[model samples]
Target: MSLSKLLTVCVIAISLNSTAAEHSRTIDIDSKVVSNHRATINGERINYSVTSGTQPVWNEEGEPTATLYYNYYKKDKVDDISKRPLLISFNGGPGSASVWMHIAYTGPRILKIDDEGYPMQPYGMKDNPHSVLDVADIVFVNPVKTGYSRILPNKDGKMPSADEQKAQFFGVNADIKYLADWINTFITRNNRSLSPKFLIGESYGTVRVSGLAKELQQAHWWFLNGVVLVSPTDIGIKRDGPVKAANRLPYFAATAWHHKALPTQLQQKDLNEVLAEVEAFTINQYLPALAKGAFISPSEQQEIAQRVAHYSGLSKAFVMRSNLDVSNNAFWKELLRDKGYILGRLDSRYLGIDKKETGDKPDYYPELSAWLHAFTPAINHYLREELNYKTDIQYKMLANVYPWDRSKNNTGEQLREAMAENPYLNVLVQAGYYDGATNYFDAKYTMWQLDPSGKMRDRLSFKGYRSGHMMYLRKEDLKTSNDDLREFIKASLKSQTHSAKY
Candidate 1:
């Protein structure tokens, strides 16, 4: 009856039946004309190639409806089949491809970051000595309509709108089903079913993983060993309801203030202690103050405004004028307006000058966008030349394909239920302290929602980095994150061992 015992039973059941009713098919590659590229990173030579091909998808009637195109990557080792753990990675635009993750974090390739965090010249690829693939097999997947994954024409043969394309192949449930089929087929073809499977998702991909986790379990009957969610966005936080969403603005403010982007006085205190006070104020006092409206009196309002200004590094008058309900967008644009600069919402440390003498929005975060070209080109070349893959498919590095649907389900509750239903499921949620988009505090709040019983709670691990959402971009942060991930994976594998003994 204990949670650990329950989890042990579930793991036993899953391991016993994992391969039941499993089927596989072979995929042949014609490599005669494919171009290959090779790169040396940290003294290790790795190869890859690009292959374009058609993948089959079944229709509603259980018949092959159409063939979808996709680009797949394999490391230097060919047909090694050592029962290595497998990692499947993707970006979150619902329309976005797997470019960032492929090049930056766990892929065999990486984009070079300059001294000031800007992507430098001579944009090229390098062997990622730090890639997690060194421990597991890596496969970056681009969903339909993103990253060369395209569906053949219907009977009428017409191109579909973005919305229509998503409705057909990019919704929550639809994506899970499609990936289940694609991954199952890929694993079957490559003969990796015995390998432990894991998924790594960022931004919107975090949302996708939440739904996919359940679908993969209930619908596909595949129990994942673990999942890593980076910069997660909880639907509950994004929605409007009676549930009081935790205020994340102060944590983001503290990060910006620490980097000297805010003011001098507030920078004097210990960051962790300051952040704790701000968090307490935001949750206990600020929420109620905002809810009371005009009845709270001007003096009380002034006190609240002063606290917001102190924690957020904004002017007291400005906070008071706004009535304390400033949204993320307003905060970004207003925070540094006096200095003729704006900070990136994704990574607050990056600063951008106003393009015109005066403009509402900052010019752009060149530091972040500039890395796309560097990584995309290198990944494409590495996959083709080093991996010995030959294909004509265009790699979709990033796309905004799938948008979050607020109506369909209780996203938070669903994840909690899945964890509760399968107590053995362990999670590693990583957050960048400087990330305003999906604040680290929000991630903590989301994790707190998981069944509070010791079994599920103990399986969960949370880590906060002193960087942005793309924490790996910073060398020091990247090193720390990589080590943390390695430890977490080891812990999960050990958990399986404990289950076996049970």
Candidate 2:
């Protein structure tokens, strides 16, 4: 049935939830509401069932400590269930809800935003024709403290202490452990054990899944077919000091080219051509100069400063003042400082009007604020009204997952290990050229450093988009990215000539 017709048949339920300490309520910890719907995706009709529910995260003693909210979308009319692919997805913030990829990218519903990704009035959702549901089943998972997922209270109505919560669900290792256990349960309950499983994560979610790739294999004995990293983090790859500082040039050039801030010669050329030039200079000249530091001669320093200022759209004086090293923050503020505007941290294409453009960093993230404005309403309405899953609890678009322990993050190496062990496992990375937070260059660097041996290099691939972090927000990328995912899923599921042996 059409979504409108499906919405007419409401199936609301009361579930346990609370946004604050005083507002706690009692309800079923493990609850679900199923709804059937149809939409035209990729020029084909897709009938799918959506299961919106919460699954319990148990402790070692087998006691329920937390419940995770998730939306599982399974396409109907599949002949062989075991051969079908299952795509598990998560968005990053370490604290962010899974709503992003759920509605905006891979799921059947998307926000009612413009082609350029600006929020529109009459906030709602529309059919996502580019969604990958046409090719594979998908589940958007909400980690603890995100979406409606929360730590449960005891039978006596006492919640776990903050320290206890951290120990169980907050840190890097703790998150991977519980979520790996949760995935095992989810797969088993859904009867997808024989299906080809793939994990896709964005931002910090990249770290989560990279670790899970290894943890699931070692801890749960669950092997995956593929992993997708969208706008990935460093994934514990080390690029400190001069290496880190020099990597900023290509991103700087990309952002500058986007705003037409580059010199007429560079601005006139294509973005890729400009980036190629900047990248070569960065490796051959910028990195070496930064390494030499105060030991470098004055002429070389002047030459380096000129090139940095030229590519970064910053003045020579400013580049010299920064000692030939410009932070992303200063670039955001300085690029359009003369124009009296600031660039969005996540997406440089989006313009922000600050009260004063004199600061090193933006007053607020323009891109995030705009996204929250659009996503917050659409997700709530889609869940409660459209999907017919009722709840008094406010669906958090971005939750307070603070004190997020970044102490021990070796997920990059873990991913390498996972790929090395499982010959069936392949990785596909998607990045946006304009994403300043986890820039495309950084994503490429992470991929390059992921498998140092280079034996598994062919199994890894990268795709860059014209937009920023959530590149799918742009209409064009929305289609291309979903296509990339569809191709990757299909390719990974193909029969391999050799077994998984090193």
lDDT of 1 at 403: 66
Q: Which prediction has the highest TM-score against the true structure?
A: 2
Misplaced by over 4 Å in model 2 are 1-27, 495-498
Give the per-residue lDDT of model 2 (tens digit) for 301-339. Answer: 999999999998889999999999999889998899999
Write down the TM-score of every candidate: 0.81, 0.94
* Per-candidate local distance difference test: 0.66, 0.91
* Number of the top-ranking candidate, with lDDT as the measure: 2
Q: What would the per-residue lDDT of candidate 1 be over residues 132-243, giving only the tens digit for each residue?
A: 5445666777676565555655556565566765666767666666776766666676677776767778887777777767777777666677778888887344423212
Q: How far off is residue 216 in model 2, in Å?
A: 0.7
Backbone clashes, each candidate: 28, 0
Q: Which stretches of candidate 1 lie over 4 Å from their true place?
A: 1-54, 60-83, 155-164, 235-246, 261-265, 355-368, 388-393, 400-406, 452-455, 500-502
C-alpha lDDT (0 to 100) for residue 143 of candidate 2: 95
